[model samples]
Target: MSLPDMRFRAEQHLRRQLDFQHVRTHGRRHDCGAFMLWYARQAAPIAPVAAVPAASTDAVSPDGATPAETAPRSRSHQKKSASGPIPARVGVVASKSAVGNAVQRARAKRRLREAFRQHQLRVPAGYDLLLVARSSLNRLEYREIERRFADACLKIFPAAKA
Candidate 1:
């Protein structure tokens, strides 16, 4: 698949430290044992970043912003995707301390991403969600994690279901 075909759109990622901080400070937090889910509604649309393939760029950083995300690069060669940004901006975190070794952390993150993508539309637009992985993430089954995520979205973002 082409880069744009697999586009996870830069705007849908919580690419700035300040964005993560804002959600943590002002958003509501829900502990699902497997992960901590943080939700905040954006006041208005933040300026959309140029379309870039997420897989080619950065990993989750300590400050939450990767150098790729922070650095301003030329948009001259970039082709804008026909689609606009989705309402939900999501950040997924898996700490070595909380989630264990590299392999385990990766698995947790992978599961979390799959769970979110499967239930993406369940979350309304303009809402930011941060998913921080816990130790339990690896222990639980993928279905269980998915169920928890869906349940959380259903309860918190019921507008989608309505």
Candidate 2:
């Protein structure tokens, strides 16, 4: 059965939530390995920060701005999933080199992808993500991987509380 929906946007205020496996849960694939965090909101992309001169004039009065203009706009589909900004990614470290074989790698990647698909909602709409396989992964059973992966997902994407 589906556990529940938890996403990054669902929890952005807490500081401690930005670490690896700070949260826990389970997935269908191998136990979760760990999670890496990222953010899509760029303070400065192509524009140089230094060039951002101080406002030449007093800011527009709040009364002048329209209500609709103040509302948060819906994100485009590209920024919704893989296309969107990836705030978090995960990596599965194999425990031993013996587990690094091609067959093992495929198994691990499959497990990772499977886990991701099962809980894609944990991730926010905008965020870049990459899952790496580690050597420590070989020793753990798939269930363990699932648990770890779930934890990582929660860390990246927290669930909405009722």
Candidate 3:
């Protein structure tokens, strides 16, 4: 089968340390054969903007609108209210203590990432997902890893299936 055109952009990943901590603290957990999935429903954080100075009354437009009034709303807010379901984001953790050597940890993380990349569409939106790898994960075949990951996703999001 041909691979889908979808790309795993940085926006789709859990990049912030706080985001991972939030999921670990508030999310529910699901365990598969070689991995544990932690997920929580939380609003995506808004990017911080430098505070703009208040416009003076004299700066008002001829149409009686301030610059702020004419400015467009944030796209993130719009995305939160869009009609369709949002895409699930993921964070993969394969620590040295959990997976031994650096090479093994890298391999384990890569496997987890590939599985998530393939099946991320099957996952529902508005969730922060974290995949913690077990030592056994390195020994598993790619297909087995994929199966376990998919099963974990299904268990967490039973209603996401079409």
The candidate scoring highest on TM-score is: 3
- Computed on alpha carbons, the lDDT of every model, listed in order, comes to 0.78, 0.45, 0.80
- Per-residue lDDT tens digits for candidate 3, residues 37-66, read 888986555755554655674577679888
Instruction: Put down candidate 1 lDDT per residue, 23-138, tens digits, no spaces.
Output: 99999998887799999985443455665545646465578987576655653212234575345778898999998999999999889888887787788867889999999888
Clashes of each: 2, 36, 0
TM-scores of the models, in the order given: 0.69, 0.41, 0.74
Clashes of 3: 0
Worst 10 residues of 1 by lDDT: 72-81
Q: Which whole-number lDDT from 0 to 100 does residue 114 have in model 1? A: 84
> TM-score of model 2 relative to the true fold?
0.41
Off by over 4 Å in 2: 1-99, 159-162
Summarize candidate 2's per-residue lDDT along 90-141 as a digit string, tens digits: 3333333535677877776667656655656665543333455665665677
Task: Give the range of the ten consecutive residues with the poorest summed lDDT in model 3.
Answer: 75-84
Residue 78 in candidate 1, Cα distance off native in Å: 16
Which candidate comes out best when scored by lDDT? 3
